[model samples]
Target: MTVPPADNPARFLGRADAYAAARPGYPAALGAWLEEAGLLSGGVADIGAGTGLFTALLLRAGARVAAVEPNPEMRAHLEASLDGAVRAGQLSVHAGTSEATGLPGGSAGLITAAQAAHWFDPARTVPEFRRVLRPGGRVLLVWNDWRAAQTPFNRAYGEVVRAHTGDDPLRVRVLEDELPQHLPGGFERHTFTHDHPLTREGLRALATSVSYLPNQGDPAYPAMARGLDAAFDAHERGGQVALAYQTQAFLGCLD
Candidate 1:
């Protein structure tokens, strides 16, 4: 597998609001899955926790959360998103990257990276995860993969992304394919379906929130926007579109 450059943090700079508003959240079933696997009882370190999306879910599942985010803007958005939980001591936000979480040894019983692991250098990050997790602690990697084949709108939107950002090397890889190769121990995987409702504006936000895509001021952005608009007009129903996702989770323990 190819390793992309470590420039994702910079790519997301100044786009925290769009990310928080547009990105889909993990399903509640994830929390249930954790509990069923007997891994929900202690401290959880949510690495690369952007805008507190998965962090919020972990907190609600009755875990003390340490949200480690490298990007300052995204960290601020995360802090804002979980203010009440922070005040209540349910969560803490740290400025840290996946390869250097700055957490104490054996501090977490569970570690997680939701929609963020592709940016990490596994050579560094896998060991860091091992350092922070207690004995028998597990790591979970999660992603909401857009199922383009599920709907015509999805297929069209995917084409738009590919047309504009195909040259970009950044891509979300399957955790099942990469985690076992890099993690100290092999992992197991599970998947579930999730759906998000989007209006035309929501669709626009989704497109702009993608880090690899050209932003509003970029020369190629107008065409991207037109593509998204065209897709929306063709498939929208009752002023909304359904974006289907295959939510994948991979779990493993470190050596």
Candidate 2:
């Protein structure tokens, strides 16, 4: 697929290769919990299913999925990589965003947005979720929060990101009342903690995968790469550095 227009939501363009190769996968426990809770019984609408990471997990847990994404590059990677599931009728990819998913009304009993809610407008996305979900259907908002952890490598990585963008790399940076205000039914949060170990090449890919930081082609990328290298050298053990991540999941019924 061709890239999205510059005026559109094309932030993930030009980095899909790095994004798919290095972004952290979700915790397996989350999938198990969702399956055990019966949330994965009916089909799932994996909103903002970038590169089909979380969508792949949902499929493994025996749920059919409609993986919806907006960026053409990201969606194309998802479609190409998960073509087996697509061919088997276990998966379908659609061109859409969180606020305006092109899924049918009441098409899914569970709606999920992993590592993506921060990109959505809750005022619009919340109601759009309700529109696609059946009565009593649930919504799950997920974020793999590396910022929640405090470790030497994590701090160093954050410093590089902050130096480049003047913003926290892994934080959603949403206002306090951004989505909470719209969740009249309230929400429950589940946390799963883990470490992701990366090689030198993997570390570089991880840095490039971040949308806020200077990418490989950017003029400032050399400086960013140096900072990341120093960080890695200071913390690497057996040729890898482990980054801590806390997968935060907020669940609620939107009916």
Task: Kindly list the per-residue Cα lDDT of model 2 for residues 2-103, writing each as its tens digit.
Answer: 222333357778889999999999889999999999998778999989898899999988999999998898999999988999999999999988778999
Expressed as tens digits, the lDDT of each residue in 52-137 for candidate 1 is: 88998898788899999988999999998799999999899998888889999999999999988888888788888889999888
**TM-score list, all predictions:** 0.94, 0.93
Q: Residue 228 CA error for candidate 1 (Å)?
A: 0.3
Per-candidate local distance difference test? 0.83, 0.83
Among these predictions, the greatest lDDT belongs to 2
Backbone clashes, candidate 1: 0
